[model samples]
Target: MQNPAIPPLASEFSDLPATASHGPLRIEYRWVNETAATAPIAVFLHEGLGSIAMWRDWPQTLCERLGMRGLVYSRPGYGLSTPREHDVKWPVDFMTAQARDILPALLDALDIGMQERTRMWVIGHSDGGSIALLYAAQHPDELAGAVAIAPHVFVEDISVESIAQTKQLYETTDLRNKLGRYHADVDSAFYGWNDIWLNPAFRTWSIVGELDTIQQPLLAVQGHDDNYGTMAQIDTIGERVPHAQLVKLDACGHSPHRDAPDALNEAIATFIKSPSKAPTSTPARSPK
Candidate 1:
């Protein structure tokens, strides 16, 4: 497919200094604070093929609605961030790397400590949603709430089939071109994600068990028409996580932020603003 003719927004923030490294990559992020009162911060993690520019005005709108600060950034090899030097496929532990390594480095680089009083809310989509869940599962005390859109907690045949079709589309159709506009090194971002999800080893991947470890409030949203993943993904999340709430949007797709922005925004705002259960004295274990 030919690259879509969408106008690119001007870079919102000039290069803030690069934070610490994660293996071979240096992490970078932009922080937008609408007030100095120190309200909760909503960290926006984009989808596999998404960049800060791709999020357009949604982050700002959400931040304004909640009267909070917003943090938005492209992962390694996406958007204006550093790109990998070689064509490397994402490993089976890609989500682990993101949760345990990249995310902490970025938060530290931006001076957002896990113990900060200002509550942290994560808004992640697709692959980002999985990463967010992993992080919340691992560090429940650090986050106030999380909203995941079309998150995949368990591998499904349908997801792999859809990804295979996407690969074919990228090769034969205008998909790659459209993706190129968002990613500086489109192939790196595209293949890094596409290859990992389609890999045979990834088929057995399931983080549903880990959801039980997450004590923070969670909201999982899925569109009925999502071409890439089924509602079973979020259903599994809710089943394992006691505080998880699931919302299904009719006629919505993988990208609910784009397909059903109004519903998505409302769902997220409510999730974040709602009162959370009292923290437990002991951390929970992963479900069997």
Candidate 2:
């Protein structure tokens, strides 16, 4: 559950006009610690099947730990935002469109100008992580830094197999019912992400070349037990951006925020304070 105590800074619909390839969108977003007038902003990007609500209290917790403000939102097809058309299939470059177009427009609509952007940090998970990296690459000067957790730079067989299994679970189990709590149109969110990953064309997708242009601080994190990807994801990131800090959590999985919040928080806090230095992983806490 989202922390009810943290007040909404800007939680309204931002109307996005229809483009050549896609329909109009109304993005839903909220802010954390908005009263921190002098603090840098940390934007939280959700995973493939994620939303503002799905983030629970993690954003607030992280923002408080880092002494920064935060922005959390659902992408167009998830949460309270507009749903994808029933007949439409997302393009192969859908993530690219999200990074280059949707995010910029949302920030503009929210009145986050170049000055605010200069101090902004993007922290994302899974698909959102990939988007964060792409955003940092495209607008390196606009952001202070980025943290990508369980991000995929290229397609992996494990990713496909896991996603395919998820699709089956969504169909055969109560997974859709569970996900329905987070998304207004659960099918839209599920299939949009599911169909794309299973698409054969996406197999050739790789974004390593784009990392060459990123100038801001970057931290790529992965878990040893992640089912969706391997250490090669962050390892490849290290290969591209030698200065990027890498963290591999012991006893953690794809979603570190959930699987190992204490360790993730400590690493992020250390990295934000010292970009050039590598973060020392905290000992994993016992599960509740």
- TM-scores across all candidates? 0.86, 0.93
Q: Against the true structure, whose TM-score is highest?
A: 2
Model 2: residues >4 Å from true position, as ranges?
1-11, 279-288
How displaced is residue 50 in candidate 2, in Å? 0.4
Give the TM-score comparing model 1 with the true structure, all chains together: 0.86
5-34 in candidate 2: lDDT tens per residue? 333435667888877745788898888887
- Put down candidate 1 lDDT per residue, 1-288, tens digits, no spaces: 212443444443233344343445544456666564467788888888788878888888878877888888888867767665555677787886778778776677667876652388888999899998998888777888888888888888888998899899999999988888877677877888888888899988888888889887888888888888887898788678866877888767898878887777777676666636322111111111
Model 1 regions lying over 4 Å from their true place: 1-22, 115-118, 275-288
Write down the lDDT of every candidate, Cα atoms only: 0.75, 0.88
Model 2 scores worst on lDDT over the 10 consecutive residues at: 1-10
Candidate with best lDDT:
2
